[model samples]
Target chain A: MIPCAVTGIGQTRYAAKREDVSMPELVREAALRALDDAGLDFDGIDAVVMGKAPDMFEGVANPELFLAGALGAAGKPMFRVHTAGSVGGSTAIVAAHLVQSGVHKRVLTVAWEKQSESNAMWALSQKFPFQPPVAAGAGGYFAPIIRAYMRRSGAPEHIGWQVAVKDRRNALRNPLAHLHLPDIDLDMVKASPLLWDPIRYLETCPSSDGACAMVLSADVTGDRPPAWVHATAMRSEPMLFPGRDEVSPRAGAACAQELFEQAGKTPADVDCAEIYVPFSWYEPMWLENLGLAESGWRAVDAGRTALDGDLPINMSGGVLSSNPIGASGMIRFAEAARQVRGTADAHQVDRARLAMGHAYGGGSQFFATWLVGTEPPG
Target chain B: MRPVHIAGIGQIPNVRGDTDHDEVQLVQAVASAALAEAGLHKDDIGFFCSGSSDYVMGRPFSFTMAIDGVGLWPPKRESHVEMDGAWALYEAWVRLQHGDVDTALVYAYGKGHGAPVDGMLTAQLDPYYEAPLGPSPMALAALQARALIDAGRLTERDLAEVVAHARRLGATHPGVPAIDGPLDVDALLDAPYVATPLRAHDEAVRTDGATAIVLSVGGGGPRIGGIAHCIEPIELGLRDLTAATSVRRAAAWAGLEQAGSIDVAELHATYSPQAVLLRQVLGLADAVVDPSGGALVADTPFVTGLSRIAEAARAVQGGAVRALAHASGGPCLQHNLICLLEAR
Candidate 1:
């Protein structure tokens, strides 16, 4: 594979509703920032790759067709990657493949979701012929799984509230984060309404509108230090089937294993990670799935995953603080790159040499993860 | 780039509509057929990728249910694209280049007859400006046809001739629906015009179908010489209608010059005039274009472009020396893909 690096990263200030700009403008905001960070213009981009959760989210169809002009991809090769909620990370991987395959040198990849245009809850809950009418959309589907995880791991109820408080506090450090509750605390999280049993309203991610973009190039060094890509991996399984382990999906575990093996590293080598924790409990669930915690819930219970802990996760508040569905995964990826490049302002991990970004979707069946480092792998 | 070969190709015959099978069954039949033809099984597929549109199905996450067709029991490594199936194939080809996966499964399906086809296509336009107008897809194509007519690029009779030729070529392929027999240019011109300067026959015969292609490295199949794609701005006002600049750029990137003499070419010309413009842009006047009637006869929304590559691969499998396949997306040929293939 050709040596590729993340030379530039960009993201918008995520919010519940971005009524100020159209979808194109919202995406352009991030794309322009990434291009500027790369010290390049449209001329420097060889191709464009876009990713989104679903067209129904924005009442648009095949958005890339309309977005090509806004993305400065006119008369250039462009592709749209969609693999459920992992689309953002999957899109970045596809763009990186173009460079790794020696097909294109510099590729621009963007992922976004403007959830304000339409009700995603209704769209996702639109019952099919054989499917039941599940209420509350994604939270409803995942609530049962969280309960099962709690039961299986015998974790305390305060664990979920603790995560909510921790991530909300971390959001105070991130200017672009959607939720910045300065007075957030464990007591406040416990006081919040229980949207789903074992998953409080405060623990759940809020629907937001946002976009993230990155400029990936092959062996192209810019003015700033590049986040050298160490390894990237993706895995998927059927959303529903008999004998499937929904609580601790084998797909997620296999994805992490393949990623670390490809990078010639292990969980111990990771200085930090940006785990996709849309719900508070997912922090522990994914920690176990990624093999980062030997005692699973006990690891987070010991405060070992705190910002100042041995391995920091979601220092930018993560999907808990800002959940733009499609852009959420790419945000994780960009944050990891930021940590290694020492560009993450308030949330920067001191002397971080390696980091990991992760995302999962479709009933936790789809997974995409990547490892980035301050130095290129030998 | 590592050499990628089209080991197998399969597709269901295009039909106006079907009430018997769902999207999953359609995709399954073609994928199973293609894998069997390649002498491989699901276990041999190192990577899986698909292309489909949610708007076409009037639902969200359209490909999610169809994932059953590939059977992710072991949780296969996979990805997806919302564009044409040809783009999915493009991703698979790129994956094969990584050498971690020697074989890839690519599939695409579109149920064009599911909704009001013309109106559904309008949703792919710019929501802020173009979608509000509620312009049917034919009306947009009409604008392009009018420009071609005014530019003296194609006459009404020329359009009719192209359709008549496509009907004849389509007659030999069982997958293409039979049109009224032996249509002459004058007879076609006499037909009612659905859009100004574009008769009913000028538009592709709308159908619903699915296609699958298995690509592998160093296989006993048609070797992929090169594969590339390009796109243009969506706004018609910003582009010159008579020129397919994206096609020209894709052709250059796909190494049309080094492809040598083209024996068979499957061009995805949903509109008859596009066939003319693609020929002009690619300088394929002497080449045999669309031996299986092209999209003008059996166009199946997202799957049509992928079917072009399958048809071209079939030609190379039938002993053709060199073949080129083309797929176009977006309005007025705003996006284009070209694949050059040759027998090993």
Candidate 2:
């Protein structure tokens, strides 16, 4: 595929709650900010692509129809994608294809969630016939998987806590991060309420109401100092089967391998990463999946993946902070692009040239990833 | 831009209710037929996109269960849209434009038999303002039909002719339920008015069905030509529903006449008058239209529009015609899509 670029990025002030604004207002703040960041306007955008988790979460059958007016998608070619948790990344992939295909010059991509609007756990529980009724929240479904991960990798128990603490501490620097735990520490996360045995309430992502947007452009049409899209890829497998590995699915691994292969680089070339970490343990879990950790060894040892460490991960406080389910994935991609464009303020990795954005959803079976670089890739 | 094409097309016979077969079974039949037509295997495609609505399934993530049809054993890079299957084809086209994958599978299914089909369409209405009225799609379309009648572009006999030809043609076409021939226009206009002004014949025979199409970049599929899609706002009050916004929008985007010319045209017009409306809205000058009876005779929910694209592809692939195909969605033809195809 031809190289696409991310020129502008925008995000709302992540908070425990955003009450005064409607869902569209929350999304508009991010989109307009992205337009401003990209130095472009509505006229410059040729099309729009929007993504979110599921329509049921918002109580709106098709949230895209309602959001059409607010997202400035009145007449232009507009598309809405729902790919479970990976929708945010999928949304960006769809938008990037518009530019890469030369179908649209500049495309506006946005994903958002008003988790405060509805209970996701309840929404996901609306079951049908012939399906398992194990809808004990996403964490409950993954706790057993985490146990399997622990047995397979022989990693210690404290690694998950390390991830929660590092992400919370990093929140202090990102102005847009939702959960800014100034007093966060290892003991605090361990002491937090245990929602699911292995996943603590504090370690879990908050039901945030926020939005993220970005302006993706072709190389020739890029207006701002663009985060040249080095490579983008996505992969998915069935949600469950006899042989499917829930903890570390082949889909996520294949997605990562393809991401780097398309970029003509390796995981070591990545300077920072904004990975989907809805729960603390997924931090180290995805580390090995992304090929950062040694195979079968899934812990961020050697003080890596920290803000000051090599391959810093989730400097935006990640899903652990502001996890507006649908927007969570796009936020990761937007942050990576921001780093490549050298526009990341407090969370910026110093002299970072390459960054990665990653997301997985639906029983850890679906994955979307991209590698962005400061320089354009041939 | 790489020339995109339709490598394969498949469809299930649109039935009122396949009581013996479920949605998954229906999807499987269509997928197998399309792949067999193109001589392609499931693994040969890199991207898979499906279109269906949760409202129709009466459950969320409705498309998840339908994957059994594709035999997605190893799992594939797949996505879904809460819209018509025609839009799924559009999404596939956009992915190919990125110049990444060469081939894609686009499929859609509508379970009209799940409940009262007309009641299901009520979900498309505005929940706050209009849905409370419980205006069934037939009645709502009748409103627009009234406006067209008042304007004198059509008369009582014209409506009947559309239905007569549609059903008569349906009786001969395979997969179409045996509808009888040549009802009177006045009789149709007076068929107790299911809503008002618009009669039963004005609407297509509602049925449960599934359809699928295989698309390739650079016209690499069995058939070839131009493919384009453009969508309008969801609000009917926002635009003139009486006009064909989708057709005009799609025609302009596809550069309908700019490219080599169109020799044939097919559109998803569930309502009889819609065919006439699209012809004028798209300014399709004397194209060989709907030789297969089109949507008026038998409209198969979300798959109807994509069926039109497949119909166009089949014609070109069979050396029957060389031209463009159009599809539509939304209430009273709110959204429109146009694709051009040619022979090798």
Candidate 3:
């Protein structure tokens, strides 16, 4: 495969709502910052790949059609990608392929979601002519799965709180995180109202309005250290099937396994990880699903994934903090790259060598993963 | 990177509406036929990508149910685009370009019959300034058509002659829907105008259907002749309506100069005048043009551009054409895509 590198990254100050800027202005803010970080201009970008959640989230159909100009994709080959929630990660992967395939020297990847503009729950719960309605929306779809995990793994309810407190505390260090709860704790999280039975409001990701962009190049084109892309993979399964495991999704596991194998590393060797955790429980759940932890998710409760412990996960606060639906996965990817580039200030992992970034959507079936390293792998 | 080939193509006869089959079933039948034609199974596909619009389906994530048609058991790598099927094919082709997967499946489906096809199309226009005015997409196209007519670059007679050819060509085809015999240009012009200066034939019917194409990597599939696609500015004011600048851009990208002499060329002309403009734009006057009719007859929404590619591929595989096929989208051909196919 042709070599690729993450040369620049930019993200907006995520929040519950950003009425100050329209969709175009919001996306442009991130795009311009990314361009500035890359030390390049609009003419320098060879192509643009845009990503977002379902069109209903924005009340716009095929957003990129109208967004082409603001994204600096005018009169250029612009591509749009939608792979459910993992769209951001897939969007980045698509842009990377343009560079990796020698089709383009540089590609700008952008993903954003302004959920405040529209009700995502109602949007996602659109009643089709024949399809069954998802009563609880995303949380309802995932709550039962969370219960199944509790039953199968025999893990205590406190494990979810541990993850929530850890990520919320991590958000204290991230200036861009949406729900930065500097004073939150386990008891506080347990007290939050339950939206989807067993899944409290605090346990779920907050709806946020934000954008994220990254200018990826084919190898380090300048003196700046590049976050070399080692391997990238994506996988998807049926939304609902008889034997599907919703808690530790097979798609996620297979994606991470193949990605790790391609990058020639094991879960233990990963210095840091940036997994999608829109819900607090997903931290422990995906930990087992990603093979970073063994069969049951005991690793999370054992403190093996603590910041100062064996593996540092979501040092950039993760989706639990920001949760810009379309851009969350890519934020994970960008943050992972930043850590390896030694550009992450407050959330940097010490002496990070390799990192893994992940995102999933479509009832936890669609998955995208990428491995990046400070030193180029042989 | 591996050279990806178009192994098989499948599409139903494109009429304005196909009420006989549900959209999902329609998509599934075509996908099944295309796979079996290539001697492949649903299990063989390593990648899956589809294109369709939620608005067209009157719901969000319209293609979600269609994913079941693939029986995504092993959870293959997949993606979707709210674009024409041809563009979805482009995404699938990009995945194949990596040499990571050998096969990619791409499909698109949208039914414009139930939805406010006209008003819904306007949504694709500039939402902030253009859509608010409610300049019906056809009315906007007519404005550009009037400019082309006033420029003396095209005439009403030219438009009718193009439609006459489209009707005859469509009637003789094996699968094209038969249109009412030969229309009168003067009568058409004299006919009440829906948007002034343009006749009903000048407007495409509200079409709904699905199309699918199978792509194989490293020459493992059918030997595709050539593939070329291009885009025009989304705004009408960006270019001359009479001039097919986007078609020229696509032709150049397809290496029209190096493609040598051709046997047949299928052009997607939703409107007869577009046929005239496309001929001038793609310079296909010397080639065998749309023996299987054109968009004037069997115009499907979203999947129509893909239908063009499939029809041309069938012609080439049948030893009928050794040249190019064109497809397009957006109002006034605001967005254009061209594919050059050859039988080696």
Candidate 4:
């Protein structure tokens, strides 16, 4: 595969609502920022690849057609990728592949979701046959799994509270993050209302409207340092089958194995990670999934994933701090690239040389992950 | 781009409604057939990509259900697009160039009867401008056809001749409904206009179906010479509806200059007048068009584009040296994909 590098990154200020701007304007904010970051305009781009969670959230079908004008991508090759929440991550991977395939150079990839335009709760809750109706929303679907993880790991009840507080504090450092709870603590998280059993309102990710963009270029690194892409991987499986493990899906494990093998590196080489954690428990769940820690709860208790710890996670906050669903995964990817480029201001981890970005969706059956480094892999 | 081959192709016969089978069942039938035709099992595929629309099924995360049909066990690398399966095949072709992957499976399916297909399509227009007016696709195509007529590029008899050719071809296909006689231009002229300047036979038949194709690098199947897609802005009023700039751009990128000797061409022309416009853009006036009746006889939104490729590949397998296939999406042909194929 041809080597590709992330030369630029941009993201919008996530919030519960971005009423001031329309969907096209919301995405242009990130697209122009990324173009400026890369020191190039739309004229330099060869192609554009877009990703979003679902069209219903924004009430548009095949939005790339309508958005091409705003992107200045008329008469250019444009593609739309939809892989559920992991779409953001997969969109980047597809764009990178275009460069890797020697088919395009300087691909601009963007992902966003204006969830405030419609009720995402209702949009996601489509009743299908041969299924119980008890599972109401996304929170309702994952609550039982959190309980199962608590039982299986025998972890303390405060682990979720700790993650909520830690991420919220990290959000204060990230100006683009939606939540800036400087006074938040473990007590406040535990005191919050329990929307789903074992999952508190504070422990859940807010419905945010935002976008993320990046410029992926083929082996033509200008003067600025590039975050060399070491590996990219995606995995999918049936959401419901005979022996499917929703809590610790084999798809995620298989995806991580392929990603590391492609990069020719292991978890120990990773300086930091930006794993998707829409809910607090996912921090621990995905940690174990990525083979970073033997037990996620134990690592949380030991502060091994803190800002100054052995392997800091979500240094620019994470999905828990700000999630626009579709753009959440790309934000993880962009944050990882930022860390390697030495551009993650205020939340920078010292001496960070290697990082991982991870995202999964659709009952944990779809997974996309990538490994990046400051120095090109041998 | 790295060279890729279309090793096998499969498609369900186009029908107005496949009422008994669901989306997964429809997809599984074609996917299994495709893999079987390639002499491979499901495990041999390195990547899986699909294209589908949520509005077709009237729900969210609709394409995820297609995994059941392909047997997503032991986990597999996969991605999807909300467009047509031709776009999915384009993604697979790109993935096959990564050197790590050798073979890929691409498929697309749509349920046309669950919702008012025409009304749902109107929603695909610019939401703030065109969609608010609720102008049906036929209405938009009629407007385009009117422009073609005024420009003297097409006429009522020209459209009737196109329909006559499609009906003649449809008669040969066993499953497709036969358009019984009275096949003269006068008969076509007698049919009432569904949309102004577009008779009932002028518009494509809205059908439900699915298609699957296997793509491999340095392996069996018809070799893909070039595949590319381009798009135009959805601002319909500002753009030239008479000519498909997107198709012209995609064809040029897909090596249309070298396609001078194409033996066969399959076009995704949902309306008769579109066939006229696309033929000019592709410059295939001398080549045989729509040997398998094209989309006019049966049009399944997501599947039609991919089936064109399948049909063109079948022609190449039947000894045609070179073939071209095309697919379009969005309102007034806002997006276009063109693929060039040659026999191995």
Per-candidate clashes, comma-separated: 0, 9, 0, 1
Residue pairs in collision within model 1 = none
* Predicted complexes: DockQ each: 0.81, 0.51, 0.59, 0.79
**Model 2 interface CAPRI class:** medium
Worst ten in a row by lDDT for model 4 chain B: B174-183
Screening candidate 4 with a backbone cut-off below 3 angstroms (N, C-alpha, C), the clashing residue pairs are B7-B221
Give the C-alpha lDDT of model 2: 0.77
**What TM-score would chain B receive for each of the candidates shown?**
0.97, 0.91, 0.91, 0.97
lDDT per residue as tens, model 4, A33-62: 988888888999999999999888888877
- TM-score against native, each model: 0.98, 0.93, 0.95, 0.98
The fnat score for candidate 4 comes to 0.80
Where does candidate 3 stray beyond 4 Å? B15-17, B172-187, B218-222, B225-228, B238-244
Q: After superposition, how far is residue B77 of candidate 2 from its true place, in Å?
A: 3.4
How would you order the candidates by lDDT, starting with the best?
A: 1, 4, 3, 2
lDDT of 1: 0.89
Residue-level lDDT of model 1, residues A1-378, one tens digit each, is: 888899989899999999999999999999989988888888999999999999888877788999999999998999999999898889899988899889899999999999999988878878766655566567888999999998888999999888888888888999999998999998899999988787899999989999999999986546888998999999999888889899989999999999999999999999999989999999999999998887667877788778888888899998999999999999999999999999999988899999999999888989999999999766
What's the residue-level lDDT of B168 in candidate 2?
63
Off by over 4 Å in 1: A127-131, B180-182
Cα deviation of A191, candidate 2, in Å: 1.8
Better of 2 and 3 by lDDT: 3
Worst 10 residues of 3 chain B by lDDT: B219-228
